[model samples]
Target: MTQQKVALVTGGNRGIGKEIVKKLIEKDNAVIFTYRSNAKEAEDLIAEFESTGIRIKALKLDVSKIEEFESFSESINLILNEWQVTGIDSLVNNAGIGFFVPFEEATAAQFDEMLNVHFKGPFFLTQKLLSSINDNASIVNISSTATRVALPGFSVYAAMKSAMETISLYQSKELGARKIRSNSILPGPVATDFSGGAVRDIEDINSRIAQQHALGRVGLPKDIASAVAFLCSEDSAWIDGQAIEVSGGYM
Candidate 1:
């Protein structure tokens, strides 16, 4: 019998992360996802899948708090053992905060927060979970289109994502011996509650973003989630160390 696949996703309670979890589950992957502090939302996500006869689990994790990673790794090991899985087949580094501080006004604290959540957090968390990640596993980092397009009020945020993109390449290079593939997905402006929901709720901002895409519409969470699911599957096995833009032909 083919072994069931397992995935560990961060920030899987809402927005793009939530949609990624659902997509993976739809692909028959057993997901063990994390949410920072929303116990209620986490519970709802678990229950929603449970009612559909899909068993999934959620844990509380603050990616900004690197100190908690060791314990979190232990918790993940316990879950893997309970599920009778040797290791997770995929690790989706999807947890992130929306920081839009401009270059002139960005503060030290904001910069550090962005670094902690985007760069430091995923870097170390992947290191911590390395032993539990199966050989040939895929690591998908959720990046932003800000890395490509120059946008005001997004200097720090985009910088952090650029760092993430760099690390993803290094991860693919170093982990190649174990056949672990690492890649980044740069999603264009999506109508989500991220960034205070300006893209989703504000018609002017939404319409402006829509014009940048060839599809003539701002991306939805499922648009990015579908790409994530593809990367995690064996269908993308030959693809590695690449940063894919899932922005509906955003130029």
Candidate 2:
């Protein structure tokens, strides 16, 4: 009998992360996801999905805190042991925050937070989880199209995301001996809560964003989620260290 494949997605409580978790479950993999807070929502999702007989687990993880990575690894180790998993098949570093502060007004704290979540968190988390990753395992880092196209008021956030893209390449190289692959997905404007306030809820801004996309609409959570699913599967085994832009052809 084949062993079940296991995947861990950070920030999997909502938005793109949630969608990714759903798709992975659909593909018949046992999924363990992390959320910083929102215990009720996390528990509700697990309860709802568990009814379908899928293996879904949720844990609280603050990715911005580097000091917690070791503990996070311990938790994962415990889960692996309980599940009898020889190694984790995939890791999705999808937890992140978006800030719209203008460059001049961006404070050190804001920049630091962005850097910690987008770049530092993934870097160290992957490091801590390296030993537990299966050979030929895939790592997917969520990034932003803002890294490629210049966006006003997103200078710091974009820079940090860009750094992750670069790190993804290096990670792929370093993990090659272990047959581990790492790649990044850069999504364009998506209808998610990342836009503070009611912008995502507002029809005007939504329409504008949709019109800006060459596909005639902004991306949905499933749009990016599908790409992530593809990368995590064997269909993309030969693809590594690449930054795939799921931006609907945004310039």
Which candidate gets the maximum lDDT versus the true structure? 1
lDDT of 1: 0.94
RMSD from true fold, candidate 1 = 0.8
Clashes of 1: 0
Question: Per-residue alpha-carbon lDDT of model 1 for 169-234, expressed as tens digits?
Answer: 999999999999999999999888898999999999999989989999999999999999999999
TM-score of each: 0.98, 0.97
Worst ten-residue run, lDDT, model 2? 193-202
Candidate 2 yields a Cα-based lDDT of 0.90
Which stretches in model 1 have alpha-carbon errors above 4 Å?
none
Backbone clashes for every candidate come to 0, 0
Worst 10 residues of 1 by lDDT: 46-55
User: How far out, in Å, is residue 105 in model 1?
Assistant: 0.8
Per-residue lDDT of candidate 2, residues 1-251 (tens digit): 89998999999999999999999998888999999988987887798787687888898999999899888889888999999889799999999887689999999999899988988989899998989999999999999999899989999999999999999999899999988999999999888898673336889988887888888988889999999999999999999999999989876
Backbone clashes in model 1, listed as residue pairs = none
